[model samples]
Target: MAIDRATAALLGGALGDALGMPTQLLTPEEIDRTYGFVDRFVAPSDDHPVSRGLPAGAITDDTEQTLLLGRVLLESGAVFDHRRWVDALVSWEREVKARGSYDLLGPSTKRALDAINAGASPEDAGRGGDTNGAAMRIAPVGIVMPFEPLEALVAKVAETCSATHNTPIAIATASAVAAAVSCGVAGGNWREAVDCAEHAALRGANLGDGSARADVARLIRDARDLVRGRPEAEAIPLIVERIGTGVAAAESVPAAFAVLELAAGDPWRAAVVGANLGGDTDTIGAIAAGMAGACAGMASLPAGRIAELKGLDVEAVRLLAAELVAARFDRPDGRVAA
Candidate 1:
């Protein structure tokens, strides 16, 4: 049977997260010295800051939080329930801490959740956040929403991201990723998907708190243009030096687009490149590979690796994808495409 676009997207992001797990925060040189081009899954380095002691093919907070958010989305349907979301995060964090993994929430999300715990409103809690935490785990939003008539999709992205990353840059960048995934799920080609992402970025910029330092749409365009048709030797350095692969939305999101462009929408290739990209590798891989998966579908990835995913419920992920697709088309406004 052919794999569905939604399933492909969710699995692809997880695979990318696992592939990049061992190399998440290492510099390129250190990655080369330790693991020598991490094209496959490997155990994290012993002294690794966040994911130390994890075995090969193990996922991090990226996939875990994604699945958690997905469950929340399923429960609430179209309307976002901030209370449910907060409860879910708190529970997930507690579980993660119990597991003794240092790979907890990212800075922006941690701070926002802390503020919320301290009695701040959800709307105000994330006002200062401007990182890629929103974008990294936003695939479910794209999976359950349509990209066309872009405003609706952008609105959904904003609503979901508001509690953890309410700043303009965070929302705008995440909207771009969500738009690409939605366009790709609709069977659009990579070029069309990226174009939709650009428009979504522009639309999302005005929805969140605080001003963005740079034009996210233009940055994505520039990132794509920088890597298009370039040789790997030349392109990788350019991406690392100019575009960057960091925790900031302005950096990692655009870098992910550039990596997607470089891989020509190949989910496996995109994930590999993202894993080897140095700083914030897992997030870059998750975002880029999620877009690639939506365009290419799950069959494009390795079956053995997918089967090797131990703790994660692969079946549940696929079922969630199908459910999200159903809910997407059943929206009251009839905004979804047939």
Candidate 2:
């Protein structure tokens, strides 16, 4: 049976994460010299900074955290549970250490969790977080919620980001990704999803610390326009240089949207191009491919590639998707089935 949008979103993020694992953190020239084109899964280079020693098709913290958030949501229902969320992060980090993976927690997440562990209030823990960590793992929030009444969705996004990324820029960027995923789960087309994302970013910017400099809505619009009719060869470099492919939420989130637009919502193509986009490649790929998969469904992904994904629980993803769909219907406004 074909998987649903929620499953596609989670799985696609993992697929993109794995696809970009080897190429992440390298310069574009380094990527070209090392892998030429990252059209298939490959083991991380021996000297890779973050993903070394991982086998081909192994996912990184991006997908692992996405699923972790999904599980938290499942256990807590639609309501936000800050304590459970923090505990899960702490436990997950311990488990990752036990496995001896260097991928550990992201900088923003680590700092916030550390503060929380030091007895800082949850509200204050993430106040300084400004990275793309929240956006990178936001797919599940989009999956479990509906896109309509976008303010509500943005509120949920804010709640999700509060534990590790409460800054305005972070919330805005994550809200954009979540809105796009929610739109896709609602069966909206790519254009509609992008539109929703922009609007959500605008709304999200109004929350959190309002003084942050970045304008995520305008950034996403510019990123999309920058690559409108350009070929992949031209657009990819343009995005890497102009919008950037860094760990900053302002950069990676917009870069992901730009890749989605450039690929015209082709999930596999989005994964491929995102993987080759250099710095923070896995995150950009995860966000872009998650959006593409949300709109196009699992059938849009290559079957062989899907089968090759390592350490991901396909059955668990499907079950979460089903439960999320049920939760959406449980909402008062839910009408059509997802």
Candidate 3:
């Protein structure tokens, strides 16, 4: 039997995280000098900030935060409890510190936490955030809300996004990623999935409580276009050239889509190319890998990388899949057509 969407998506993301951890902040030149086109997961350097001294296959904050959202999804069932979920993130960071791990929290999230500590409400805590953190863990939201009406999906996704990174672009970006995952689970082809994602993102852009540039949607569209018809080897520099791989939702989210387009929905290649993309690799890799894996299922994922995954909650993901499948809200019967 094939690996289910949940398992494939989560494990695929973990593979990307492990593969990218060693080169998290380095330039392509630095990465090439240290490992020469890394084909395998390697241990992080002690000088590394977040993942130092970890085992070869250890995952980082990307996978860990994904798991945190997975747990929140399981605990809350189909409801999007904004307060509980954000609180759990703060708690998760504390746990990371308690364990003596140095996996850094992103700027938007750290600011939100500081806001909360300063007596701001969770709902108010992330009003100013505009980073990729909101999009990073949003796969769980899409998993449970599969098949919902497009408007409703976008609205709910934006509401969830409000817990952190609440700018219009941030909300739209997360919705796009989640929308793609939902489309993939419904068995849509890659182009169809991407098209659906753009629609959801556009719809989501109007629903958030935060401020954002009016041109963000156009920027994302431009970034997404860079991957179409381009050779995989040429796509990365072009992506870095224009799309960027920074922490801002606009930069990182579009970079993720470029990977998806480059891979043509191949989970393994998406992960590999994402790892080599040279900035914000793990999150971008996870975003693309999750969408690709959801569409391809476990059987189509690269066997070698899946075998190399370590420290992932494989059993938990399997269990979560059963619940998400049962809770699926909506999908047209002809979902493959987008």
lDDT of 1: 0.86
Check candidate 1 and list the clashing pairs.
Answer: none
- For all candidates, the clash counts are 0, 0, 2
Cα-based lDDT for every prediction? 0.86, 0.86, 0.75
Position 270, candidate 2: lDDT? 91
TM-score of each: 0.96, 0.96, 0.91
Residues 42-76 of candidate 1: C-alpha lDDT, one tens digit per residue = 89888989878888999888898888887788787
Clashes of 1: 0
Model 1, runs deviating above 4 Å: 1-3, 332-338
lDDT of 2 by residue, 82-176 (tens): 88999999898888888887354678998987798799988889887889999999987787778787777888889888978998899999999
Give the TM-score (vs. native) of candidate 1: 0.96
Better of 1 and 3 by TM-score: 1
